[model samples]
Target: MKYQFDKDFLWGVATASYQIEGAYDQDGRIPSIWDTFSKTPGNTYMGHNGDEACDHYNKFKEDIALLKKLGIKAYRFSISWPRIFKDGKYKLNEKGLKFYKDLVEELKKNDIKPIATLYHWDLPQILQDEGGWSNPEIIKYFVHYASVMFNALGDDVEQWITFNETSVFLYLGYLYGIHAPGIKNLDLTLKAIHNVHLAHGETVKLFKNSNYKNQIGITLNLSPNYPYSVEEKDIIAAKTNDAFWNRMFLDPILKGSYPEEILNNPFGNTLKEIIKDDDMEIISHPIDFLGINYYSRSVIKHDENETFKYKSIPQDGEKTSMGWEVYPDGLRVLLNYIKENYGNIPLYITENGAAYEDKLENGKIHDIDRINYLKRHFISAKKAIDEGVNLKGYYVWSFMDNYEWAEGYVKRFGLTYIDYETKQRILKDSAKWYSQVIKNNFIEE
Candidate 1:
């Protein structure tokens, strides 16, 4: 069976600035929250830092050649905020600006569209020092940053995403103390969530008000929640999980309102008090598309003694290298749910790939598991499209292996394997499979 997509359907790969672009302090680049967080003792796994990630900062041409070799139509990369504003102010860094400009030009030379992300969890440390996303002033600063990028690359870059996975950043960084600026406080996390939504809304408005001819949207790590049982308690628990994880951002952005169920949780009333008039209007900025990064799903069951009063039950199924359950049907369900609730907004699978223990042998990596993982999800995505989901693109989570955040370099989620010691990129079997998929523009089973 072969599934064909629209001729213009985008096929791409994604990587973040800090994850791939090493040269942490080079060319007037300042420290970001990741830098501070990783440097602090006991923050990151194995004390891993992005000091010399993939050296993409210096070898961007080589990376572009790789993308061209893959026959990719688009490449989604992020711009570092601290690189643009060294002091976390409106002051532009010419060297940092020129680096990305050169990269974008190189992509254009290869006929690859540059899908630029404004932020990808690399907030300037200066902003962090000033309360970061918890501060309302950060909204203005972010808008200014967005304006600078829009004006700089607006002519060439046609696809723009304001931020990547605010929920992950807020919940992990603040609530779980796992990522940057590690703080374990729910109130601060909630505050950060509010401010990030505000910033995203403001940035979207800024892009719309600009003279750029492009599509603007935001990317979210969306996972659909399923009930563990048909029992009433389990069903209600699933609903609550949906309100917390999915609807928290989707409802505000798509429906112009936060989920009433969220406000009725233990902290619900307090959250309502924190929400001000017109905030929802700001968050409800019209977007050209919604980027969905789906990997797996969670089954929820009622738990009276659990921290959130509901527990996520792991299905008895195969798991990924990251310990995430492998459930491809969840992607179809999520896309269908979004289509039904979000009014048929154009959507893109911005990041959907699995991590597997990749082993390099004889200068080649045979990651059949990754190939199978992607194949299953691609089929699921195709099913969603066939069922009338407006999915416009599908980008693998990573093009090459680089830093894996708190887990450091342990988890490999890339089609190309990287030698951390030598910074060498070796195309794995999955890369070849993915390239073939791009060449055909459809996967055949």
Candidate 2:
């Protein structure tokens, strides 16, 4: 079977600044939260840091050349906030701006569209010291920084993502203390949640009010929650999980209100204390599209002892290197759910790919597991499109293997394999297969 995508359907790859761009301190780039957290003892795998990650800051031209070779129609990459703001202050960094400008120019030279993500979990450390996302003052700082990018890049970059994976960054950073600026406080997490949404709303307002003609939106790591069984308790537990996991973020931006279930009891009381007048209006401002980073689904079972009265039940299936189960049909179900619940707004699969145990043999990588993962997901996306969902584009999670946050370089999620020691990039079998898919704008199984 061969599934074909429209010519206008963007086929691209996604990457983040901190994950790929090494030169952490070069060219007036200040330290971000990741830098501080990764440097602290017992924070990351082997205490690994991204100080020399792929050296992309020094070899962007080479990387852009690689993108051109892959026949990608678009490239989604992030801009480092610390790189643009000196000492995490309101000062401009021309060198930092120039690097991205050069990168955009190179992508245009290769006829590839540029999609920029404003934030990808690399908050400036100075801001963290001042309470980070938990501080309302950070909203103005974020808007100012975004305004600078709007004035600098403008229409040269068409699609702009206000933030990437807010749930992962906020929950992991504040609630779980696993990612960066490691802090485990539910109070701080609740504050950070409201403030982050306010920040996103303000940025969208600024973009829409600008003279530039372009698109702006947010990317969320959404996992569709399914009940473990048909039991009424399990069903209610799944609904509760949906309220916090999906609706808490989606409702503010798409529906202009928080879930009533969440606002009723337990965590709702804390969230209510921080929300102010017109905050939801700002957070729910209209935008062009929604970017979804779908990886897996959750099976919620009733748990009287667990917080939220629910716990995830592990499903029996093939798992990725990240220990996430491979459930491709979840993508189709998620897309349909978004369309039915949030209105059929334009959508993009901003990040979808799996991490696997990639082995290099004879100067080539035969990552068949990763390839099958992508193929199944792609078909699922096509199914959604056929079912009248407004799915427009698909950007694979990564362009190359780089620093994978707390997991460090152990989990490989890229089509291109990067040699950490030599900084050499080798095209894996999946990359070759993806290149053909991009060229043909279709996939065959």
For residues 361-424, could you state the per-residue lDDT of candidate 1 as single tens digits? 9999999889888999999999999999999999998999988889888998988888888888
Whole-model Cα lDDT per candidate?
Answer: 0.89, 0.93
Q: Of the candidates shown, which would achieve the greatest TM-score relative to the real structure?
A: 2
By summed lDDT, which 10 consecutive residues of candidate 1 come out lowest?
Answer: 264-273
Candidate 2 backbone collisions, by pair: none
Which tens-of-lDDT digit does each residue in 237-284 have in candidate 2?
A: 999988878888999999999899889967778999888898999999
* Model 1 vs. true fold: TM: 0.98
List the pairs of residues colliding in candidate 1. Answer: 263-268
Q: Give the range of the ten consecutive residues with the poorest summed lDDT in model 2.
A: 265-274
Candidate maximizing lDDT: 2
Q: In candidate 1, how many Å is residue 307 off?
A: 2.6
TM-score of 2: 0.99
TM-score for each candidate, following the candidate numbering: 0.98, 0.99
